[model samples]
Target: MTWNFMCLILSLFLSQFVHSLNNNTTDSLDTCLQDFAFRTLIRHRPHTGNLYNAMLPANLSGMSVSIVRLRSRRLWNRGANFCNFHIPSRTIPVPHVKRLALVYHDFGNWSSHYYTVPGYSMITPVIGFKVFDASNMMSRSVKKLSLNTMGKPIVIRFSNSTLSDGMVSKARCAIFSSNGTLHLGEITLANVCFSQDQGHFSIVVPLKRKRGQWKLWAIGIVLGIGGFILIGYVVIASVKVLKAKKIQVMEKQADEDLVLDTIWVGRSKMPSATVTRTQPTLEDGGLP
Candidate 1:
């Protein structure tokens, strides 16, 4: 038992390590993508608001990144909308920077490598955006920022998302936030999700039940109930049979315990008891 308990502890630790390792890998990937996005912004400072695609190395081929710069006031009045992300008006960056760069990323075919919602399968590629301070592009230091949506949510739309059989009814919005937390919410529209902050988001459906499994389950339940009822009836019948046999044994014992005279009835012998309560008294009792 001690050995088994120790093994369980070890397994738990390993599972936690694996979970953290995935998050760590995604974190590193995000750092790399941010660097690439910042470099793209620096290379194209002339066009402040145009979405410029960042050229990634062959190692990250399927993934795409883009960046767009906007002033703080413009973001408050006309929120930036590009790369499948919609930031509505009245949104502003936290810590209040004069300008911010919105970096967009489409994880493309590699969406499952860095993130997964357990018991769910991804139906669309993971797409996300991050905000960073771009107020002083000349300076080397850059910091990340957060968005306050003011109760109005940011929309992430999955275009041309095709839900296969058995997934249409179960599909839901999965948001893996940047802060190491996950959230699941209902799918708004056909294939869309809303978030109040920056995060990687996707559409996921619960794992499907195996074919014909429910039939087996139903059969097992029916058999269990039937077996229980059969056992109950057998027990009741056995008890009644035993009671009848006991009553016969008691009658036999009573017949054996008493001595009786036998009389011939019409065609059967009947047990009859005959006894004198008092004998003839002697002269000592004379006349009573």
Candidate 2:
């Protein structure tokens, strides 16, 4: 009796295990079908990719984004392309990002369909071309170069302009304790653009700011102005002093001339003048 019961129980256990495996397999298949259906619906929509791509820039952090293709059957034109990347703020400040995005809206004409999608537009690229042939496009090379390059923030720039010329590209971030609370400061970003381009493309290359250069320039300007002002003041003061000395000398000469004229007049009024006049009157009477 004990052997029969154990055998029956063992058979029931095996049956249950097989049934469970079947159910699990069915569930997985259902999930896969659902995914396929959803992706198909997205594919059939008109300009749906464009709308999604437009919204990408708002959601981006430290990565390069581009639109590669639109709706089409070709592998290249079927889906949106995204490049996943994360950069440490301290490693690259103000990244000079040059990553390009492309969109092949239709595969019917492969060459004609190669459209360089705008920054605001959404695109889908061939699954294989998501990174756009990294090997040929130097993707790995750029990535390695960026990783090896040192990045920083707090850059100062100097220019011929009276004001500083340094640009504050992206910043590296750090957390500091303030009043026992964590305070987040500037996080240097590798998304900076240095090109004279009018668009707001993120840059990936790091550049250092010119520091302490402003002080030197300011000091130079101040000294130059001060020297010019001092020289002008001295010249004015000297001119005033020389004019006063000349006026004093002229006054002294005038006083000396007046004294000499008075002395000559006094001699002419002396007693000898009165005797000469009396002698002249006597001679006139005798001759008469």
Candidate 3:
């Protein structure tokens, strides 16, 4: 009966342990799934007075969105300002978009006719936009648009234009966007364009899905390799120490043998004296 009770108790403990382990594994998987479902949103605080906003298209809803701030350009003169915004190859959640657009509000006080050609009556400030995908070796150019002080926003939508993996979008004017969740109809350009003076801008990026778990896995692999190397080094060092101790023990034994040999040689070299005087005294006494 006692043995049966002990076996039952052991089985119960093992079952509880296994149940706890399974629960822990389920919790870990849930955590990973949660992290994978949502992309981290970055907030951009504009330095200039011009307001910048990003939002999803009115039609699409319930989708994860993230906005990344790209490099901005500052316009200094009437001459064309050329700048390139490259989507980093290592960006997590690869950006994939079917449609892209640039929207800007005219905020500059300068008239479009400020820079006039010699023969023409007026010349407008022309903005050119281009998208380049180096991997595919293809470049798409947007028609040059002239900007005027209309106190209203302008939307330049790219129809059937898609940004592939690792593409660069280049613009020839001052534009910017705030960091936010990228959604459909989400214009990434600044609310207002600075035709004159210094201005800041960012590109709107639409990402496919969260892919940050790969980075975590890569880190874990590196740490595991380092641990294995450390363990190997400790094992090698232990082996070397053990060999050195064995050699020391052998050397000690050799030294002891040499000392014993030296003592034996000394004892063998000692001379032995005879008792001839004692024998002659005893014979003389017996004769008397």
Query: Best candidate per TM-score, number?
Result: 1
C-alpha local distance difference test of each model: 0.82, 0.30, 0.31
Candidate scoring better on TM-score of 2 and 3: 2
Judged by lDDT, which candidate is best? 1
lDDT score of residue 266 within candidate 3: 52
In the range 1-288, model 2's lDDT, one tens digit per residue, is: 353344345434433443343334423322222222233333544233342221111112221223332222222222222332222223321222332222111111121122122221111221111111111232222121111114222221111112111422333211111112222233232322121111111111133567999999999999999999999999999999999999999999887765322223544742222223444445557632
Q: Residue 23 CA error for candidate 1 (Å)? A: 1.9
Candidate 1, residues 1-288, lDDT tens digits: the string is 353344345434433454455565566567667777777777776476788898665556688998898998999999989998999999989999998999999988877766789999898999999999998876656799999989999988888577654554678888888877889898647777888899899899888769999899999999999999999999999999999999999999997899989999999999888966876677898645
Candidate 3 per-residue lDDT, tens place, 1-288, comes to: 353344345434433453343334423322222222111111344222222333322221221222222222211112122222122222221133222222222211121211112222211122222221112111222221222222323333222234332432322222322211111222334221232111222223333355898999999999999999999999999999999999999999986775322223554753333435544445556733
Q: Which ten contiguous residues of candidate 1 have the minimum total lDDT?
A: 3-12
Q: Which RMSD values do the candidates have, in order?
A: 9.9, 26.7, 25.3
